[model samples]
Target: MKLKLCVSNTDVLLSTLSAIQPLRKLCVLRFTPVHLCIISMALNEPQAWCKISQEVFPLYEVESIRDNVLCVETNIDPLINALRNFDKSNSDGLSIRLQRRPVANEGPESSKKNRSMAVLSLIYTEHVSMASSRSYSFKIPVKVLKAEIDQGIVEPQLTHAEVLMKLDRDILPLFRRIERYKRSGYICVTGTNRGRLELSIEEDSRKVQLSWKEFLQVQQLEGETQQQSQFSTQDQDMPHSVQIKLKDWRLGAKLTELCYKVVMIISENHALVLHCILNEDETAEVTYYIGGKIQDQE
Candidate 1:
């Protein structure tokens, strides 16, 4: 299997991977014929799914064993650092290709047949202002997907919420009040369809509630509104809330740096989905699925 990607827009690709680093350390890098997908580890923390189209890379090629899909597991830090260095190099061209290296094991069935390791070879040309140019290449080891193990990785099947809220772009200001309290580990986020969102945390008798009332716009999911009824009950009138760890919540908050618009889809007591729009056209975006925590109120 052979895979090569020529990154045309370094900024867009950099922002995408940078957004994923907080929540995930190691993620599967999948390259399809038309898209580059990042699948986070199936852990208890927030799971991320980022899809960027091939248009970002003018020359995107993959010759994999199955359906032209190449999946390899690698650390995100090196990839992020490589892109940062790409700027320092004043790179004229940047490309990444997959290479195989043979490993020496003590016990081998045949000397001719040794275990092969997969690596991503990053190659770029650096142009110096002194009318001098140099080339650089580095290898990042990776683990190729084995059969159905990683192929089974899929987006969380979240129960759709009819009400979707377009959060304030500058929400970091609101988070400051709660961030100062080191005693609190979790925050209760409650939102109503009436454009009100309340973030509250309680430790013993001391309580703090920060409300963003009537400042945000709430809407229905594209195909979900039709199924939900417009009835007012004690349950429906109550705000949809989720108790999530502050650390996990910050992961989604970090995405605002790359995304144009930050939307939140909340299924009370179940999960909170952050739909981050990377571009105006919405062709490329990231979906962060954060599961709710069921802890005692005491």
Candidate 2:
């Protein structure tokens, strides 16, 4: 159902997975209408926490950790029901204290003192009305926290802005013309203003050159599929017009695992073309671009 986990210490975020791995596996195999929520409390502001929620239903693959954000995919309705049930249950303070303290599980037994820690305070809800009636909560203690931390388990730091900036400056600049075309939204030939020119890219050599008008006309006569989508449509739709030019363009690079799609416009060479860099959907963590046409260089 609905699970709420709060971490007070900022550094604990790293080992979150390993620390909860045991519990997660158990819950995954057992819980119904799976929905999970995580809240990270501010170190300075003890009362404030960043909360994220997701549904975990029909026990599937173990989702990997990335960008300090945990993602879980499952059906929505069941998770919603679980959340409802969580709210139904009421409580003043979480209940997680040992009756007579068990022996220290690690190191010397008497040397260690057992301290109470709240790993997570979970709640489950059923229907919008009756859901709140069947809820439960659990708080993990400090001993478990220490064990997880010592194991060095967690996700890497999130430097999305820095990563994107580096990609634009270093990687995209190598194929300045191609990047420009991708942003502009089309592939056009230089020096042909009235008639459309055919363009082709060499896969092996990575070279590019304009095709003859006759060649394109022949293809057209042969009923070959031609790009009917006008590039001007994109330019006209842009809030502002910024033209980019290219010289002897070629497919310089292919991007994979990109979270966002970006469009750029280049200036000076005297033609406008739009190009797209493939985002394989694995590497990128954030959506970089949302709009279709870009307006003037920043």
Candidate 3:
């Protein structure tokens, strides 16, 4: 099996991966004709599922023995370290290739147990200086598991949230303040049809609420007309809110450095979803879902 792709903006892609590095140690990278996706799942309570996407890369040439899609599991730290050499400004382009290689055996008796190994190679180059090019490769082992294991984890339906709105300013500062006070807390989000939204953190004695008036207009998701109408009638008095862990909410803060705008969805005690756009064209998006603390109320 062989797969190769050329990346136009290495900085954007690397920054995207850096955001996911803290979520989990192991990341499952998937490549298809359409997009390159990275999926990571955190352990224990208040678990999170993050998917980072690059819709249109420079290239997506694949040659596989089995199927068109290729999946590989690799350590996130090593991959991130390998990509640190690429300068965001000077780097011309990046190329990634996945292929199968034979595992080397030092002992003579080990030859009998020889097996094929999966290798991921990353090549970074500078168009101006041919001598500045460098290549880094890593052996990313693969495990055999049921294909249905990730059925419901990777791409979840976003039908849970009724109120959706886009924030005007960067939220990293707010998240930084929240992280200092509490590691985990609920994100009480309330929105109105008049394009006003408020995010608050109320835990114990600490209470902080950040409100934005006349931000971007409220966005009505598909089939959300009824909910929008309800919000309009109630004005800003009745706002849909969700309880989410502060730690999980902070996971998406790194995206603020790359994403210009953030779209937030509140499911009212079910879940909180954040869609971050990585590129100006809106072709690439990174979505994060944090399950709410209170699950019963809808």
Best by lDDT: 1
Best by TM-score: 1
lDDT by residue for model 1 over 52-90, one digit each (tens)?
888888788998778888888899888888777876777
lDDT of 1 at 65: 73
Candidate 1: worst-modelled 10 consecutive residues by lDDT: 226-235
Model 2 scores a TM of 0.20
Candidate 1: regions farther than 4 A off: 102-116, 129-131, 160-162, 221-237, 281-283, 295-298
TM-score of 1: 0.87
Candidate ranking under lDDT, highest first, comes to 1, 3, 2
| Residues 212-289 of candidate 3: C-alpha lDDT, one tens digit per residue | 544545676556566556556544444677776666766655555557677877776777777777667666667777
How accurate locally is residue 21 in candidate 3, as Cα lDDT from 0 to 100? Answer: 73
RMSD of 1: 3.2
Residue-level lDDT tens digits of model 2 in 121-237? 233322335444434643222222232332342222222110111123233333443443333333432222222233333335355544433311111111111222343531221
Model 2 weakest 10-residue run by lDDT:
215-224
lDDT of each: 0.77, 0.26, 0.62
